[model samples]
Target: MKQLIIITFFLMSSVVLVAQPTFDLGIKAGINNSKVTFRASEYNSESIVKAHFGAFGRLGWGRIYVQPEAYFSSKGGEVFEEGTPSERAGRFDYNNIDIPVLLGVKVINGGMANVRVMAGPVFSVMTSNKIDGNDLLNKQYYEDNYFGYQYGIGVDVSNFFIDARMEHGGELYKHPTLDIDGKNQTFMITVGFKIL
Candidate 1:
């Protein structure tokens, strides 16, 4: 009788483990509010709002998961100086491809709803950059690539998800002659649907 009970327990545990969900793939798109901040510049900056769209894949084991995403993003800002007739000092336009690999933990699991917190480093490859209607790519004013980080919270409901995140990028480019040092900062909101 004891042997039969032990056998039954093992069978049920194995079935439960096999039934757990482990992987998901999704597409996401959202709005991005971004800005470029100068470390030593005469002008103040303003936020540049744009849109970002991407696809992501997630792998999970128990309550922990790792997610990787690829996205096209637009980021830049406008500069303003004091005592200027025009409030606009100059405008920066940057387009890039970004990848973020995140590590996350599910903090709350409520059947149909789950709350998660995630953070990770990001790598951005620049596609183009312009300053005041001039091309900065050929001038070598900024680096072609940058390193950054993103952290935020997310909610998963049924097959849909919503996330809000903040990102800060490291120095993007360098202009020794012009004495320019700038970084990227952004706040983003995204919605996603699981397709696979």
Candidate 2:
């Protein structure tokens, strides 16, 4: 029994020493096409194109993983209203800090490449907002923080990855008197390289 116990302990230690660690750090850059949707109005805004860049850290154990990222993103859209013999149009702009935490699983691990599916919640804080060339920060007309979610599929090849995702904002602005209830929706594609 004593000899068996010693052998078991030795085997466990050897397994621990030989196992590989499952952590990676990466950098990513992407483009986003974003729009604002109103709940009760037909005045839909046009989609705006923007760029996003960020760094992410991923931790994985076998086929399951979690990835958290911090990035800079640009958002907002143009609103146009048709009036009598005329048209009133303006644009809204915003710069934001976006953070997303995603849980994922590797569905196919093919030696040099892998396929993954992920979904998670995102939190964003507006750094600056402008409408029709007027700053919303000084005007105090809108909120600064927002919540959203994203789901996507990704392909990883060695140290590089590509991801395509759809994201939607939960609540934008709601004013019953003004009839302004809107949310944001975005489509994005990103490419990344693992650094660690």
Give the Å shift of residue 87 in candidate 1. Answer: 3.2
On a 0 to 100 scale, what is the lDDT of residue 102 in model 2? 96
TM-score of every candidate relative to the true structure:
0.83, 0.81
lDDT of each: 0.85, 0.81
State each model's C-alpha RMSD to the native.
4.4, 4.9
Per-residue lDDT over 35-128 for candidate 1, one digit per residue giving the tens place of the 0 to 100 score = 8887765656789788889899999867789999999998887765545545446777788899999999999977579999999999999998
lDDT score for residue 142 of model 2: 50
For model 1, the stretches where C-alpha displacement exceeds 4 angstroms are: 1-21, 82-86, 133-139
Q: RMSD (Cα, Å) of candidate 2? A: 4.9
Any runs in candidate 2 off by more than 4 Å, and if so which?
Answer: 1-21, 82-87, 133-139
Cα lDDT tens digits, model 2, 92-178, are: 677778899999999997857999999999998888877773221122545678899999999999999999999898765555465
